[model samples]
Target: MNNRILVTYASRAGSTAGVAEAIGKTLIGKGLQVDVLPMQDVKDLSPYRAVVAGSAIRGQKWLPEAMQFLSDHRSELSRKPFAAFMVCITLSMTNAGQYLEGLKSWMSPVRDLVHPVSEGYFAGALDFSKLPFSLNVLAMRFVVLIGVWKQGDHRDWSAIHAWAESLPSRLLQ
Candidate 1:
Protein backbone atom coordinates (compact mmCIF):
# COMPACT_ATOMS: atom_id res chain seq x y z
CA MET A 1 0.00 0.00 0.00
CA ASN A 2 1.20 3.52 -0.74
CA ASN A 3 0.63 4.53 2.85
CA ARG A 4 2.40 1.61 4.47
CA ILE A 5 5.42 2.23 6.66
CA LEU A 6 7.52 0.45 9.24
CA VAL A 7 8.85 1.91 12.44
CA THR A 8 11.41 -0.25 14.11
CA TYR A 9 14.01 0.12 16.83
CA ALA A 10 16.76 -1.53 18.82
CA SER A 11 16.58 -0.68 22.46
CA ARG A 12 18.86 -1.56 25.34
CA ALA A 13 16.90 -0.27 28.34
CA GLY A 14 13.55 0.28 26.57
CA SER A 15 13.63 3.99 25.83
CA THR A 16 14.17 3.49 22.12
CA ALA A 17 11.27 1.08 21.93
CA GLY A 18 8.97 3.65 23.51
CA VAL A 19 10.19 6.19 21.00
CA ALA A 20 9.43 3.82 18.17
CA GLU A 21 5.90 3.26 19.44
CA ALA A 22 5.29 6.97 19.71
CA ILE A 23 6.57 7.42 16.17
CA GLY A 24 4.35 4.65 14.90
CA LYS A 25 1.34 6.22 16.57
CA THR A 26 2.14 9.55 15.00
CA LEU A 27 2.44 7.95 11.59
CA ILE A 28 -0.90 6.25 12.11
CA GLY A 29 -2.43 9.60 13.04
CA LYS A 30 -1.20 10.87 9.70
CA GLY A 31 -3.33 8.11 8.11
CA LEU A 32 -0.46 5.82 7.22
CA GLN A 33 -0.51 2.12 7.98
CA VAL A 34 2.38 1.30 10.29
CA ASP A 35 4.01 -1.50 12.18
CA VAL A 36 6.32 -0.86 15.10
CA LEU A 37 8.55 -3.76 15.91
CA PRO A 38 11.84 -4.52 17.55
CA MET A 39 14.61 -4.43 14.93
CA GLN A 40 15.54 -8.06 15.39
CA ASP A 41 11.94 -9.15 14.86
CA VAL A 42 11.53 -7.58 11.46
CA LYS A 43 12.31 -10.20 8.85
CA ASP A 44 11.17 -8.47 5.67
CA LEU A 45 10.77 -4.98 4.33
CA SER A 46 8.72 -5.71 1.24
CA PRO A 47 5.44 -4.84 2.94
CA TYR A 48 6.48 -1.30 3.71
CA ARG A 49 6.94 1.54 1.28
CA ALA A 50 9.10 3.42 3.76
CA VAL A 51 11.14 2.29 6.71
CA VAL A 52 12.09 4.25 9.79
CA ALA A 53 14.80 2.65 11.85
CA GLY A 54 16.01 3.76 15.25
CA SER A 55 18.31 2.72 18.03
CA ALA A 56 19.58 3.50 21.48
CA ILE A 57 23.17 4.63 21.56
CA ARG A 58 25.82 3.05 23.72
CA GLY A 59 29.50 3.92 23.84
CA GLN A 60 28.95 6.50 21.07
CA LYS A 61 27.56 3.94 18.65
CA TRP A 62 24.20 2.64 17.52
CA LEU A 63 23.62 -0.59 19.38
CA PRO A 64 25.16 -3.57 17.52
CA GLU A 65 21.80 -5.14 16.64
CA ALA A 66 20.47 -1.96 15.05
CA MET A 67 23.61 -1.67 12.94
CA GLN A 68 23.31 -5.32 11.98
CA PHE A 69 19.65 -4.84 11.02
CA LEU A 70 20.60 -2.06 8.63
CA SER A 71 23.42 -4.12 7.17
CA ASP A 72 21.25 -7.18 6.82
CA HIS A 73 18.54 -5.26 5.02
CA ARG A 74 20.79 -2.93 3.09
CA SER A 75 19.75 -4.00 -0.38
CA GLU A 76 16.03 -3.41 0.13
CA LEU A 77 16.61 -0.35 2.29
CA SER A 78 18.80 1.33 -0.29
CA ARG A 79 15.99 0.97 -2.82
CA LYS A 80 13.30 2.47 -0.60
CA PRO A 81 12.64 5.63 1.35
CA PHE A 82 14.65 5.05 4.48
CA ALA A 83 14.89 7.34 7.48
CA ALA A 84 16.56 6.91 10.87
CA PHE A 85 16.46 8.14 14.44
CA MET A 86 18.66 7.77 17.48
CA VAL A 87 18.15 8.17 21.22
CA CYS A 88 21.14 9.01 23.30
CA ILE A 89 22.21 10.54 26.58
CA THR A 90 24.65 12.64 24.57
CA LEU A 91 21.86 14.81 23.22
CA SER A 92 21.17 16.13 26.74
CA MET A 93 24.70 17.51 26.79
CA THR A 94 24.90 19.42 23.50
CA ASN A 95 23.44 22.36 21.64
CA ALA A 96 21.47 21.67 18.45
CA GLY A 97 24.31 22.60 16.07
CA GLN A 98 26.89 20.74 18.07
CA TYR A 99 24.65 17.71 18.53
CA LEU A 100 23.98 17.46 14.81
CA GLU A 101 27.64 17.73 13.97
CA GLY A 102 28.81 15.29 16.61
CA LEU A 103 26.20 12.62 15.93
CA LYS A 104 27.32 12.43 12.32
CA SER A 105 30.26 10.32 13.42
CA TRP A 106 27.89 7.84 15.03
CA MET A 107 25.90 7.52 11.80
CA SER A 108 28.93 7.15 9.57
CA PRO A 109 28.56 3.40 9.22
CA VAL A 110 24.86 3.60 8.42
CA ARG A 111 25.50 6.41 5.97
CA ASP A 112 27.83 4.14 4.05
CA LEU A 113 24.90 1.79 3.38
CA VAL A 114 21.76 3.92 3.54
CA HIS A 115 21.07 7.58 3.00
CA PRO A 116 18.23 8.68 5.24
CA VAL A 117 16.00 11.44 3.94
CA SER A 118 15.65 12.64 7.53
CA GLU A 119 17.21 11.83 10.86
CA GLY A 120 15.85 12.44 14.34
CA TYR A 121 17.95 12.75 17.44
CA PHE A 122 16.28 12.69 20.84
CA ALA A 123 17.44 12.54 24.42
CA GLY A 124 17.16 9.12 26.07
CA ALA A 125 16.26 7.97 29.56
CA LEU A 126 18.41 6.17 32.11
CA ASP A 127 17.57 3.46 34.62
CA PHE A 128 20.35 1.73 36.43
CA SER A 129 18.19 -1.24 37.36
CA LYS A 130 17.82 -2.15 33.71
CA LEU A 131 21.57 -2.35 33.15
CA PRO A 132 23.99 -5.02 34.27
CA PHE A 133 25.52 -4.54 37.68
CA SER A 134 28.93 -3.82 36.23
CA LEU A 135 27.61 -1.13 33.93
CA ASN A 136 25.46 0.19 36.74
CA VAL A 137 28.58 0.64 38.78
CA LEU A 138 30.41 2.41 36.00
CA ALA A 139 27.47 4.66 35.19
CA MET A 140 27.03 5.42 38.84
CA ARG A 141 30.66 6.52 39.03
CA PHE A 142 29.95 8.99 36.28
CA VAL A 143 26.68 10.02 37.83
CA VAL A 144 27.62 10.17 41.46
CA LEU A 145 31.34 10.85 41.57
CA ILE A 146 31.72 13.16 38.59
CA GLY A 147 28.20 14.61 38.83
CA VAL A 148 28.02 14.11 35.10
CA TRP A 149 24.63 12.44 34.73
CA LYS A 150 21.26 12.39 36.42
CA GLN A 151 19.15 9.26 36.24
CA GLY A 152 15.72 9.91 34.78
CA ASP A 153 13.63 10.03 31.65
CA HIS A 154 14.98 12.76 29.44
CA ARG A 155 13.07 12.18 26.17
CA ASP A 156 11.59 15.28 24.61
CA TRP A 157 8.17 14.29 23.30
CA SER A 158 7.42 17.62 21.70
CA ALA A 159 10.59 17.34 19.68
CA ILE A 160 9.81 13.71 18.91
CA HIS A 161 6.27 14.46 17.70
CA ALA A 162 7.51 17.41 15.72
CA TRP A 163 10.07 15.22 14.00
CA ALA A 164 7.53 12.50 13.29
CA GLU A 165 5.13 15.06 11.90
CA SER A 166 7.74 16.05 9.35
CA LEU A 167 8.53 12.52 8.23
CA PRO A 168 5.52 11.70 6.06
CA SER A 169 6.48 14.50 3.72
CA ARG A 170 10.05 13.29 3.55
CA LEU A 171 9.14 9.62 3.36
CA LEU A 172 6.07 9.71 1.11
CA GLN A 173 7.11 12.36 -1.31
Candidate 2:
Protein backbone atom coordinates (compact mmCIF):
# COMPACT_ATOMS: atom_id res chain seq x y z
CA MET A 1 0.00 0.00 0.00
CA ASN A 2 1.16 3.50 -0.69
CA ASN A 3 1.64 5.39 2.57
CA ARG A 4 1.07 9.10 2.74
CA ILE A 5 2.67 10.81 5.69
CA LEU A 6 2.25 14.39 6.78
CA VAL A 7 5.03 15.94 8.84
CA THR A 8 4.02 19.22 10.40
CA TYR A 9 5.73 21.52 12.86
CA ALA A 10 5.58 24.94 14.48
CA SER A 11 9.08 26.36 14.72
CA ARG A 12 10.23 29.62 16.23
CA ALA A 13 13.83 29.72 15.03
CA GLY A 14 13.95 26.91 12.46
CA SER A 15 15.28 24.07 14.59
CA THR A 16 11.90 22.38 14.79
CA ALA A 17 11.38 22.99 11.07
CA GLY A 18 14.68 21.30 10.39
CA VAL A 19 13.63 18.30 12.45
CA ALA A 20 10.35 18.08 10.58
CA GLU A 21 12.12 18.28 7.23
CA ALA A 22 14.52 15.57 8.27
CA ILE A 23 11.62 13.34 9.18
CA GLY A 24 9.91 14.01 5.86
CA LYS A 25 13.10 13.19 4.00
CA THR A 26 13.52 9.97 5.90
CA LEU A 27 9.96 8.93 5.18
CA ILE A 28 10.36 9.83 1.52
CA GLY A 29 13.49 7.71 1.39
CA LYS A 30 11.39 4.89 2.74
CA GLY A 31 9.02 5.29 -0.23
CA LEU A 32 6.28 7.20 1.49
CA GLN A 33 4.71 10.28 -0.06
CA VAL A 34 5.46 12.87 2.58
CA ASP A 35 4.28 16.42 2.95
CA VAL A 36 6.36 18.58 5.26
CA LEU A 37 4.42 21.68 6.21
CA PRO A 38 3.96 24.26 8.89
CA MET A 39 1.08 23.70 11.28
CA GLN A 40 -0.77 26.75 10.04
CA ASP A 41 -0.86 25.29 6.55
CA VAL A 42 -2.30 21.98 7.61
CA LYS A 43 -6.03 22.45 7.86
CA ASP A 44 -6.85 18.81 7.36
CA LEU A 45 -5.32 15.40 7.98
CA SER A 46 -7.70 13.22 6.02
CA PRO A 47 -5.28 12.79 3.12
CA TYR A 48 -2.52 11.14 5.05
CA ARG A 49 -2.09 7.56 6.13
CA ALA A 50 0.12 8.62 9.03
CA VAL A 51 1.00 11.89 10.67
CA VAL A 52 4.08 13.16 12.44
CA ALA A 53 3.53 16.41 14.26
CA GLY A 54 5.96 18.37 16.37
CA SER A 55 6.74 21.78 17.76
CA ALA A 56 9.43 23.67 19.58
CA ILE A 57 8.70 23.92 23.25
CA ARG A 58 8.65 27.38 24.76
CA GLY A 59 8.05 27.86 28.48
CA GLN A 60 7.52 24.10 28.70
CA LYS A 61 4.55 24.07 26.33
CA TRP A 62 3.87 23.42 22.69
CA LEU A 63 3.59 26.46 20.45
CA PRO A 64 0.01 27.70 20.30
CA GLU A 65 -0.48 27.01 16.61
CA ALA A 66 0.84 23.48 16.98
CA MET A 67 -1.39 22.86 19.95
CA GLN A 68 -4.37 24.16 18.07
CA PHE A 69 -3.61 22.02 15.06
CA LEU A 70 -3.57 18.92 17.19
CA SER A 71 -6.68 19.96 19.02
CA ASP A 72 -8.46 20.54 15.75
CA HIS A 73 -7.42 17.24 14.22
CA ARG A 74 -7.35 15.03 17.26
CA SER A 75 -9.95 12.59 16.05
CA GLU A 76 -8.45 12.00 12.62
CA LEU A 77 -4.97 11.67 14.09
CA SER A 78 -6.15 9.10 16.61
CA ARG A 79 -7.25 6.81 13.82
CA LYS A 80 -3.87 6.89 12.08
CA PRO A 81 -0.29 5.95 12.82
CA PHE A 82 1.04 9.00 14.58
CA ALA A 83 4.36 10.10 16.09
CA ALA A 84 5.66 13.28 17.70
CA PHE A 85 8.82 15.05 18.77
CA MET A 86 9.76 18.30 20.52
CA VAL A 87 12.61 20.70 20.02
CA CYS A 88 14.00 22.20 23.19
CA ILE A 89 17.33 23.26 24.64
CA THR A 90 16.31 21.27 27.69
CA LEU A 91 17.24 18.13 25.76
CA SER A 92 20.90 18.96 25.35
CA MET A 93 23.01 15.86 24.76
CA THR A 94 24.46 15.83 28.27
CA ASN A 95 21.29 16.14 30.34
CA ALA A 96 19.46 12.86 30.68
CA GLY A 97 16.80 13.86 33.17
CA GLN A 98 16.03 17.12 31.46
CA TYR A 99 15.87 15.32 28.16
CA LEU A 100 13.44 12.79 29.60
CA GLU A 101 11.27 15.49 31.06
CA GLY A 102 11.28 17.48 27.85
CA LEU A 103 10.36 14.38 25.90
CA LYS A 104 7.57 13.54 28.32
CA SER A 105 6.16 17.03 28.23
CA TRP A 106 6.36 17.14 24.45
CA MET A 107 4.62 13.83 24.11
CA SER A 108 2.08 14.32 26.86
CA PRO A 109 -0.39 16.17 24.69
CA VAL A 110 0.12 13.74 21.86
CA ARG A 111 -0.58 10.85 24.19
CA ASP A 112 -3.73 12.53 25.44
CA LEU A 113 -4.84 13.35 21.89
CA VAL A 114 -3.80 10.31 19.92
CA HIS A 115 -2.34 6.84 20.19
CA PRO A 116 1.03 7.46 18.58
CA VAL A 117 2.99 4.52 17.28
CA SER A 118 6.28 6.08 18.38
CA GLU A 119 7.61 9.26 19.92
CA GLY A 120 11.10 10.75 20.30
CA TYR A 121 13.02 13.65 21.72
CA PHE A 122 15.89 15.03 19.70
CA ALA A 123 18.48 17.41 21.14
CA GLY A 124 17.75 20.99 20.03
CA ALA A 125 20.13 23.75 19.03
CA LEU A 126 20.24 27.07 20.86
CA ASP A 127 22.03 29.96 19.25
CA PHE A 128 22.24 32.76 21.76
CA SER A 129 22.86 35.17 18.91
CA LYS A 130 19.53 34.34 17.32
CA LEU A 131 17.49 34.81 20.46
CA PRO A 132 15.81 38.10 21.28
CA PHE A 133 17.85 40.37 23.54
CA SER A 134 15.90 39.52 26.66
CA LEU A 135 16.06 35.80 26.03
CA ASN A 136 19.69 36.08 24.99
CA VAL A 137 20.58 37.81 28.22
CA LEU A 138 18.80 35.16 30.21
CA ALA A 139 20.51 32.41 28.22
CA MET A 140 23.86 34.05 28.68
CA ARG A 141 23.32 34.19 32.41
CA PHE A 142 22.09 30.62 32.32
CA VAL A 143 25.23 29.57 30.51
CA VAL A 144 27.39 31.48 32.91
CA LEU A 145 25.62 30.19 36.01
CA ILE A 146 24.35 26.73 35.15
CA GLY A 147 26.30 25.97 31.94
CA VAL A 148 23.18 24.87 30.09
CA TRP A 149 23.24 27.18 27.10
CA LYS A 150 26.06 26.19 24.85
CA GLN A 151 26.25 28.07 21.56
CA GLY A 152 26.13 25.63 18.69
CA ASP A 153 24.06 22.92 17.06
CA HIS A 154 23.64 19.93 19.41
CA ARG A 155 21.18 17.92 17.31
CA ASP A 156 21.78 14.17 17.05
CA TRP A 157 21.30 13.47 13.34
CA SER A 158 21.81 9.73 13.64
CA ALA A 159 19.20 9.41 16.34
CA ILE A 160 16.73 11.46 14.32
CA HIS A 161 17.22 9.33 11.24
CA ALA A 162 16.85 6.17 13.27
CA TRP A 163 13.70 7.44 14.87
CA ALA A 164 12.19 8.42 11.53
CA GLU A 165 13.12 5.11 9.94
CA SER A 166 11.61 3.19 12.80
CA LEU A 167 8.29 4.93 12.50
CA PRO A 168 7.19 3.11 9.38
CA SER A 169 7.96 -0.26 10.85
CA ARG A 170 5.94 0.50 13.94
CA LEU A 171 3.05 1.90 11.96
CA LEU A 172 2.99 -0.87 9.38
CA GLN A 173 2.02 -3.33 12.05
Query: Among these predicted structures, which one has the highest TM-score?
Result: 1
Question: What tens digits encode model 2's per-residue C-alpha lDDT throughout 19-58?
Answer: 9999889988998889999998988788888888888887
lDDT of 1 at 147: 52
Worst 10 residues of 2 by lDDT: 93-102
Candidates' lDDT values, in order?
Answer: 0.88, 0.80
Candidate 1's C-alpha runs over 4 A off are 94-97, 135-144
Give per-residue CA lDDT, model 1, range 1-173, as digits (tens). Answer: 66799999999889999999999999999898999999889999999999999999887789899999999999999999999999987677545457678787888887888999998888998888788778745865576456566678989898999999999999998
| Per-model TM-score on C-alpha atoms | 0.92, 0.87
TM-score of 2: 0.87
